[model samples]
Each structure stands twice: as structure tokens, then as C-alpha cells.
Target: MNEVLDDPVSQTMIDIHCHVLPETDDGSVSLEESVEMCRMAAADGIKTIVATPHLFDGVHPPPSRDDIRRKIDLVMEASGGVVEIVPGGETRYSHEIFQEARDKHTRIRLNGSSYMLLEFDFMMVPPNIEMTIFQILQAGLTPVIAHPERNARIQLKPEILVGLIERGAYAQIDAGSLLGSFGKECETSVKQILRAGLAHFLASDGHHQDRRRPLLSKAVSIAAEIGGERYAKALVEDNPLALIQDRGIPFQPEPDLAALRGRAKKKAAKSWYAFWR
Candidate 1:
């Protein structure tokens, strides 16, 4: 497990959507694979990352948070602090799905650290989408919308995101989407999110070793190009730190989406709540 430990930048980036745990879901299938991914993330200049395994109805059968932490401890022992894996999970948005996740032990929270990461179905918009978001917020946790840009229905109606933002929902685009790594539509939509300023957080949503490899460096570059390095750093670094520490994340937006998206085209992570049931 202690294969690679010479991670140089132990003070820079904090990846928001890495799945470095083994076998809980579609992340690294084993502990050794998770270690390798951590090494790769460390090489890519990430200092810290959340191990957001999939917490959905279809995949994992709701693992315990204690179990999740035990695995993280294993990875921590293996990596020797080269990369720290915290307890978090990429949760699917369904009261039913979340009910299943409540049995889980390690559930990843939102960037604000007030809520958890939550993803909806990509094939169609969730029923009562806005109301569901409100319910999540009413539950005393921030509602982070995971990769809304990839959702086909939202893509057709970009203005939906404006409403989401107006109602206090935070939107995060997948790291791969920023790089156009998902597909042309995801690429175009990411551009729109950036231009519209709809995206508040950027995450890797990484699941595998090859194409889905952890690359905060690339996202940093894009953020620099589109929204200055300091701003990018806030989403990947400061904001994330505040989240894990359970601190309030102040919203200081630069480009306003309601005004910005009036002339632009795109769209938008949440988790944790599924496991607390």
C-alpha cells in the first residue's frame, strides 16, 4: 500500500470528487488500486481529496460510515499521508436512494461543508426538482447539485439553473466536463456554465485509473484561463477546506449567472445525506 509517498505539493489543491476507495461502488475496485490513484492525484498536485464513493440505489448496498472510515484508514496507512482521503460519497438524489445511503458510514459533504454532494438522474430531470432541492435545504444541509451540465433535460433548458442558483442551490461541474473529457455536449455545456457563472465548484468525478484519472492541474489551468487562478483556488482549495472542517462557506460570486446566462448557454455536486439515514 505504501507504494508512492514522495508527493511534492502537499499544500496546494484539494480535489472535490475523487473516488479512491476500493469496491464500495465504481471507484478503485480494490485498496491497492485506490493507493495508486492517490499517488496519481498527489503527482497531479492535489494535497487533499474526498473519497466520494457512489451512494445510489443501483450500485452499493449502502455501506456503513464506520466501514468507510476503516477503509480510509487503510488507505491512509498505505499512502503514509501522501494524500489524505476523507469520508464522503457521491450521493444520488432520491429520498429512497438517500434512505439507503443513511446506513452508510462515510458520506461526502458539500463544498460549503454545510450539505452533502447529490446527483440526479441524467436521463431525465428528477420529479419536483426545485422542491426537492428546497427539501434538502430545509433538512438543515446545503444542497449541492452534481454535474447538471450532463443532464439532458437541463441542457435543453439552461434557465433552470438560474432558478436553482436563485433558490440557494450550489452547482458543480465535473472536472472531466471542463476538459471536454465526457463528450462534446458536456464540453459545450461546461463552457456555458463557465460563461454563465453557474458553476460554483469543480470536481473530478473520477471513477477509474485511465481516462478518469485525477487531474486537478488541468482544472487549475482552465480556471486560470476562465476565472483567474485565485478564484479557481477557492473552489478547489479554500472552499473545500471549509467544507471538511464544517465551516460556513461565504458566497462571494464574481460573474452573476442570472445576468451572465442571459447571454450564455450552460449548466452544474452533492453527497453525504444518503449515508446518515
Candidate 2:
């Protein structure tokens, strides 16, 4: 006898980070743009997208939870239910963020799970990043470092990311970085992270319909080329779905130290040359 059972929800592609919430941050401009972003994501085979708007309390205040819900509802309706939108925030590292998530006073989580998207400044990793990661873990939430490859500090010191991953945090690679949209450094660092098996998720980090658009499908092939087919599939699907469902992610590969050291040396040499120039 063949008993077949499958949950469609569990077998869908999930984008853990995106900036598609209209008027929330620097993502989509209006409700129309948000709907269009969702449409684009659905067309590109993304079944779920976490609208992770920039959430910096004093710097870039995010929309209220109710407001975010309204926008998501609007976009979901506009997308004709082809895609699912969830409220989340791309929170910059701060000492107070963990408590904020614990209180449930805001949407700091990825779809109300313990998995939170933590972003750093594009230029540098904060001096207290290690302490902050500790704090997040203490609060019983897993911090998913958003786009470490794009940070200049991580690009210069790739080992810093290895340390972060070792400290029990996951790293999410941006699809744009894989496609060399940002620059060579970002692309190289992302490949190194993937090759080393340190990267846990791949997201679009989408902003608008055109430039920073949602193109996660393209990253799947690149991830396979760099990290093998299984790791690439997990990056886009399995791992992200686990976070969404509040379950343990099934895949966590050991980091390749030899590859990390090679990337570190190359990055160091590049930085030293730029300094002399």
C-alpha cells in the first residue's frame, strides 16, 4: 500500500528578508509598489516573503504592527493569494532589541518566530556585535545576521563572520551579492561563505520592482554552483521554512576553515593594496 501525504506549505520557497512593505522604510514607495513587489516575487517562484523593513528606533522608525499588517493584507489581496507576506523588520544591532522582541510590543521577528533578522551597517560591523549576539541568544532568540557579505568590515575580515557563526548565529546571504550587483568584494565574500558552508539562508533583500527587485530564483543556480545542489536548495527552501515554522533547521554544515583562510588572505591583500593606493 502506498500512503502519500504532503503539505504544500512545507514544500514552498521562502524568502526570509525583503523590503517590500510600502512606505515602511526604503523599500517600496507606496501600496501599489508593494503589491507589484509581491506579484514579482510570486512570478519568480517565491511562495513566502518576510517584509523586513528597516527598524532602527531613533534612526528609521518602522511602521506600527497594525500598519504593517494592513499593508501585508493589501498586498496579499492584490497578489490574488499567489504569494504570502509576513511582517518582520531588518533590525540593526542594538542592546535593547532582544527585550523588545520578548515583550511582543512590535514585529521584530520573522513571522512571529524566535528567528529575528539582524542587520548591520553597510560600512562596518559594530564594535559590540559579539556582545549583542550574546544578548540575543540569552533572550532565547536566534539572530539571523542579514547580508554579512555586504558589510565592509566582513569583506575586509572574512574570519569575523566565521566567529559569528561559531557563536551560534546564522548568516543570510543576499541574492544580489551572489549576482555581483553590489561589487566584487560582496560577491567573493558570499561565495566564500557558501563554499565554507557557513551561510544558512539566501534572500532577495528586495526593495522595489526594478533595481532591487525580487530575483531569488537566479540565486538557486549560483548557490548550487558554489555550494552544491543540496545546500543551495536548503538555503532557499528548507532552512527558511523551518524558521518560519519555528522548527529546528535540518541542515548545518561544518565550516571549511581552509577556504576561509584563503579568502581572508586574499581580502587582506586587497585591503592592504587599497590602503597604499
Candidate 3:
């Protein structure tokens, strides 16, 4: 039986990232395309999908929360009995936007979830990234890092990611990367991160039908084969569900090498022998 069997069919699936907002960023270009994306998601049994359109500094300007809400209503009306579309924005991370987030703008969070899905640039990472994340925590919102494997900086130096997790930030890998959909570098690094137990979330991040359609299940199978099915469920469902709750989601601290320093000594000292005795 699948580890997913733990949850009933209705609760088995939730997509944390999708771009069903019409003519927004590089995602669905029209209402028709948005409906198609919804249909695709519904066809695959995805009950909930958070529409994560892009927001950045100098790049594509993202729509505001109100705009996202209106569009969500539009999607719901145009769903054609497809999938349920919720509101989330792939928010940009920079010290510049940090003030704006607190003062001017707020985006849609995961449906009834405290976690806000966010992403960084493909090229350079934000300089004061850690401090900004601390600020986010201080403000009482959890930041779910989107597509860490696609970031060139993190791919080059994976430990940079370890530092982020240690600071209480969670990482979400793109489903397409598991299928080598991004490229060789992203695919290789994503697999490595999964083995390292660095990935806590998985998302479709689908942009279109012909190329970037939703593939959460396929990615789940890939993760199951590589990292065990249980880990896959946690990455896709358990961790995400924890984030969705009203209070802050408490997670085990990031995997730390220092804590594993005395591994062999403890392994030999294990109390499993008591059970056998």
C-alpha cells in the first residue's frame, strides 16, 4: 500500500505552487489557459492548488493581494468543474521588499495556511537573505522557500542551503526538477538535496500546459524510489499540512552535522538490545 493511503482520497493531494492567474508573469496567459491548468490538476486528483504568480523587484511586477483574490474568484467561476484554485504569490526576496512587505503589500498565503510560498532570483541571491528571513519569522509568518534546486547559487554551494534551514526556513523543490525538466544541474542537485534530507516540500511550479503542466504524483514516485516513500509523503503532504495550521508550524531543527559527531559511539550504545532481551 502507498504511504499516501494514510490520508483519505480527499485529503491526499494539495498543490502548493501553480500559476493559474491569467496574463500574470510567465504563467497562464488567459482565462482559457488558467481553466486548462485547473482541469489538468483536477484530472490528477489534486483537491487544492495555490496560485503562485511571480513578484519581484526589478523583474515582473506581481499583482497585489486584492488582485489575486479577484482573480481567484474568477478562476473559481471559470473552473468548469476542474480544480479548486487558491491564492499564493511567489514573492520576491530582497531587503528592499522586506519593508514593503511589512508596510505596503501582502500576498495570498497558502489556503488557510500560515506559510507563504516565496522564491529568489536565478542568478545572485539576496545579500542579507538570512536577516530578512529572521524578520519574516519575527513578523509571525513562515517562509516556504520555493525551488531551491533551481537557484544557481544554492546549486553551486549546497551548504548555503544548510545555513538557511538551520535558520528555520523550509525548502521546497520543484517537481519538474525530479524529472530533469529544468536541466542537468538542477536535476542533479535536487536529487542530492533529497538524499541529504534537505527538501521539506515539493511543488509543481507549473507554468503552462505544453511544457510546465502539474506533475506532483510523478515527482512523488521519483522521490519514493530515491529517498523512500515516507520521506516523499512528508515532503509533499505532512510538512505542508503542518505549515497550514493557524499557529506556527514547529519542525525538527535542520539536520546538523555537529549533532551526528558521536554517531558510532551512540549506535553501539543503543537500547534496542533491551527490546530483544
Candidate 4:
């Protein structure tokens, strides 16, 4: 069991996605920034944050497992154990990458659990998303699609997200999107996903100390307003905690695929009409 799970104290929030490791990627620039990020999370009532640096994207190679462990230890120590940092990786989409993950040759799984945080390009969904998600499930890991609501493709065609969910992949909504920090399009997508019960987790994809900080209180409140209190808490707290502990989400709700497609078609029709106007 994780030390966080072992502790009896209850935490109101758990951010499953955060780039808080110092100098690891484009996240916190230094050790002080990483510690400051933890302070910010703790202040926002976030007792746990997964230190997910980017992996296998041809951008920046992730740190070694040993280095990540060392940084987690350093950050935890610096935070005086107020907040726990779990090990994870935000991996880009690719058949080979998902294959490696399924083979258990990669430690990039979230907190060493069977849940993998998978990301697609902002402007497009991968052509092999369905097959890749099937492969992930076959490999004994669940694919948690990171911040689908922020993806331009998903924002335009939410049916893409409905398809992924129907194929057994989960979706994580960015806290910034719910808080309208990303933009109007992302915020609209957040509301749509919430309405369809497709958003399974909420995370602070916190990259820096101030601008993209680990602030989730407002997002949580907004989620509650949109989906009711139980659903809201499940997104930011219950589901993420279960992922960290390698347990199934206690409040998994079935995605409303029919409603999602209907909304997407209606939106598309409106756009087509406007194009001719």
C-alpha cells in the first residue's frame, strides 16, 4: 500500500497529473520550484500529486526510474511529508509505446500501477487510438486519456471521445479547462464531457509555479455544479486516489454515448449552416 493510503488522514483532493519534478521536462525549472509547487498543492487541499514527466515523445526523454525516485523523495522531504508525490509518466501516443507499456518493460505506468496516462496531439486524435486502447487493455493496463477536452480534435468532434470511452478507455479532464484557464473551447468541451459522464478524472497538469500552478479548488466546485457533488468529488478525489492505490474507481459512471453523438452532430450541423451564411 502507498504511504498515503496507509495514513489514516483523509485528503480532499488528489491531482493525478502534474509536472512538478524539477528540471525533469518543461515542468518546474529547479528544486525550489518543485517544492513551491507542492506547497501550492497542499494549500489548495491537494494532498497527493503524481509527478508525471513526459515520456517517449521524441521531445524529451524521461528521467530514469532511479532519478524520478530520488526527486520524489527530495520533494516529499522538502514538503515535510505534507503532500505525497507518486511516480507516473505522460506518454505520447504511439503503437510501439503502448506495446512496450503492455509488455511491462516500462515503469511509466502511473505510480507503477496498471493505469497509463496517454496523451494525443492537441490538434488531432491518433488514427490507431481504438486499436491502441485495446492493446493497452490486453496488456493489463487501463488507458487514461489525458486532457481530451483540451484537444482541438475532441473539442470539434466530441464523438471521438465518445468512441474512445465506449472502447473502454477513460478520460481525464484538465483542471484548467474546467476553470476556463485554457480558453472558451476547452471550457465548452469540459462541460460537454461532464454532461455525458465521460470525464472520469480531473487533474492539475501543473507545469510551473504560478501560471499553471496546482490550483484545483475552483475546478472542483465547478464540477460539482455541473455534475452534482458526488460526481465532482469522484473526478478529482476518489478516482485519482483509486488510481494511485491501484484500485478500480469506486464511482465509475457509464458514458452516455447516444447523447454525446447527438450533441456532436447538432454542433456540426450548426457549423455547416453558419459556414454558408
Find the candidate with the highest lDDT and give its number.
4
- Candidate 1 residue 171 C-alpha distance from true site, Å: 1.4
Per-residue lDDT of model 1, residues 78-139, tens digit only: 76777777777777876654353343222545322556877878878776878877766765
Ranking by lDDT: 4, 2, 3, 1
- Model 4 stretches astray by more than 4 angstroms: 1-10, 102-105, 258-262
**Any idea what lDDT model 2 has?**
0.83
Q: Please, what is the TM-score per model?
A: 0.84, 0.91, 0.82, 0.91
- TM-score for candidate 4: 0.91
Candidate 1 steric clashes? 22
How high is the lDDT of residue 210 in model 3?
A: 74
- Compose the digit string of candidate 2's lDDT tens values, residues 1-277: 0011122223258999998877877789987888777767776778889888887745667677788788889887766766788878888877568658677545788888888899887888888778888888887788999999999888777889988888889999999999999989789889988998989999999999988897698888999998899999999999999999989888998988898888677767978999999
Decoy 1 TM-score against native: 0.84
Which tens-of-lDDT digit does each residue in 159-206 have in candidate 4? Answer: 888888888889999989988889998998889899889899999999
In terms of TM-score, which candidate is strongest?
A: 4
**Under the 3 Å rule for N, CA and C atoms, how many clashes does model 3 have?**
0
RMSD in order of candidates? 8.3, 4.8, 9.4, 3.7
Tell how far residue 164 is off in model 1, in angstroms: 1.4
